[model samples]
Target: MSKSYSHPYWLDVPALKGQAGQPPDGEICIIGSGLSGVSAAYWLLEKGFEDLILVDDQPEIAATFRNCGHILYGTVESMKALVALHGEEKAQKLWALSIDVCHEVRDTMQRLAIDAEYRQEGYLVMAIDAVEDREIKESIALLHKHGFDSAYVDQKELEKLGFRNVFGARFEPGSAQAHPTKFRNGLLQHCLKRGLKYYSGVSVKSVDEIQGKVRVQTERSEHWYEAAVIAANAYSPLLSRFFAEHHLVEPFRGQIICSEPLDEPIPVSIPHSFDHGYEYALRTADNRLMIGGWRNHTPHGEVGTYDIGVNPEVEQGLKDFVAKHYSFQKPLAWEHSWSGIMAASKTGFPFIGPTDSARIYTVAGYTGHGFSWAHGSAKILADVMNGDPIPPIVAEACNPRS
Candidate 1:
């Protein structure tokens, strides 16, 4: 199955130069061009770090571009599961940090003047079974305990929201939706204007800790920097061999399908599933039903895979799910379909900070919530690299020493 978004809905950004160039001595060298890397670049640019290099294997499209674009304040069911594994205090702190990240994304987008079609529409996690309904209710309670604004919606309310066969639902108003590719491209453009260097299609072959600086060897040329950041999503493992020993991150494939432009929009806001494997139906400005999520149907097949091709069963499942719940007047045709690999962490939190080597920093293992958390993670990472105080929320969730 070829993994790609099934629709032509992305806001295109210019292609970046991927061939290696002379390694200008820099304050920071980031090794990914996704939201996390670009967001870090944008924040550093704001802080007056002109010397930075952003590198990626696939410059144009990757996990960040293929995201469902839901800017959520907390993890789906996995967050509560983290509470079970790590304890309530740690889980609460993690959720609060995620909320902070969501706010940071909205503020950064506004500050950068990036019109990525952002919407404040809250995310609703709908349960279709009894056990899932109980889980949703428990999660809502945990959310409130952590000072988050959330409420459990009954079947009547769920039906009013155009959801059928839903046992229950939970609503979080702090969540949002956006066009991810456009947001990433906008940040990249801003980074370019701020004098940030980027090399696309260039994979970092090796990272060597030299004298006091980090030496990054690429397929084309060798570059050196005072500090290095690995924000390459699931692909980070390929570059940072130490990542394999940590057992903190794994790659999961997410597939999506888009319906042809409808006469009228189906969902005015973002609608996702309770199981954490599906999110869909954010109406495009042009009234298209852009939807994705069905990897649970083939969980074993999706793990550790980076291919961006379409899966027929997953695609058809999306179609059936949409038709069963939402009312569409016309016969829907899928315009585009694609898949991207998302990094899942064992702790259900992102790993961001300096590694064993003082020069090597990392920001990956977002656990499928990078859209909300990436910007804040980037900001804190840039600050840490510059010898500034790390944000408290970031400090708690991300401990490279852990």
Candidate 2:
């Protein structure tokens, strides 16, 4: 079963069909068509790499397109929690990279002329529980210590933002939201124009590194390349043997539902969340409610591979949440229901860079914050492939041998 976004709301973009046969031999082979893979291809093209091939089994509608499109400058998990897990320096570096990537995403969209409803209206992390409120306060303090601007807002402030049931909230002004599928499709179209060859419906079975050449086998045929990138997100572990041992990239499925266009529009475009059960609502250009999140309640059930079909329990949970939190006056008709898989690491940061196998490189384990960090990770991987100096942060984050 495949995931599908609710329709009759946001702008529609045409899908890119997958390649029918084996990919043509190229200088570089990217094994996923998600934002990270596409972004890497786009940046590589910008750096003048002509021969590139991108492969994906579900290229037209992968997890990247399925995201709620929250371009956050911070982690969905609180900063204080990350600091406790990976220490202050590592946590701060992760947070800083996310911020950098947010800026990079804006620049890329602008340069490419991709109108994704891109905005920096800020992100609100609200708390529906006492534990979350405590975490929010600590997160505010942590952000201040790391030189990032964030404010701890009380219930009154949350009410002003049209959000209720907020024990407390932390606001980060640098975050953003956008129409995800349109943005990804726009990038794909741009890549095609720039000579980035894409092969959808083609899954790479195995990759073998032999004597300066990399051989990749798909269902139908095999192709060889000089370099390769495994940017398949949650689907990456299945292709890379290195990821199997050093990384624990657990896949968590998220369900999203959209409401029919309302008579009165939701005033803002920014996303809101409470108790880590993200409930983001953004108004489309035509004024419809596109909201997603609430997998926290059934975390065990949501953990698995990339299946787009909605779980009945998760779907009902989202419906109940929308009824309680959102402002669609009448019984909101569910236009669509879909699911996307996100990879999370035990340490709560992603692995990005060359693996033990020199020919294979990867960037996965976004932990639900891939949109924010993907661009920078792609840039770093491109630089590494080009034999340039890899940044220290990239080196730290790249746990090929973890």
Best-matching candidate per lDDT: 2
| lDDT, candidate 1, 197-295, per-residue tens | 887667788776889988888877788788888888788777786676676589888887765667765644564654454655576666777777767
Total backbone collisions, model 1: 16
Q: After superposition, how far is residue 24 of candidate 1 from its true place, in Å?
A: 4.1
What ranges in model 1 sit over 4 Å off?
Answer: 1-8, 11-25, 277-279, 299-301, 389-397, 400-402
Candidate 2, residues 1-402, lDDT tens digits: the string is 123343313325655665676689988899888788888898788778889999888764467767777888877668888788678998898788888888888888898899888878887777887888998898899889989999988877666655555688888898888777667778878989888888877877877788889888887788899888888878777877777666658787877777666776463556766667466656666566677777767757577766767777877887887666554447676676777778887556677777777778777777777886777678877777778876776566545354
TM-score of 1: 0.90
Spell out the clash pairs found in candidate 2: 3-308, 18-200, 19-200
Each prediction's TM-score versus the true structure: 0.90, 0.92
Candidate 2 ranges beyond 4 A from true positions: 1-11, 299-301, 397-400
lDDT of 2: 0.75
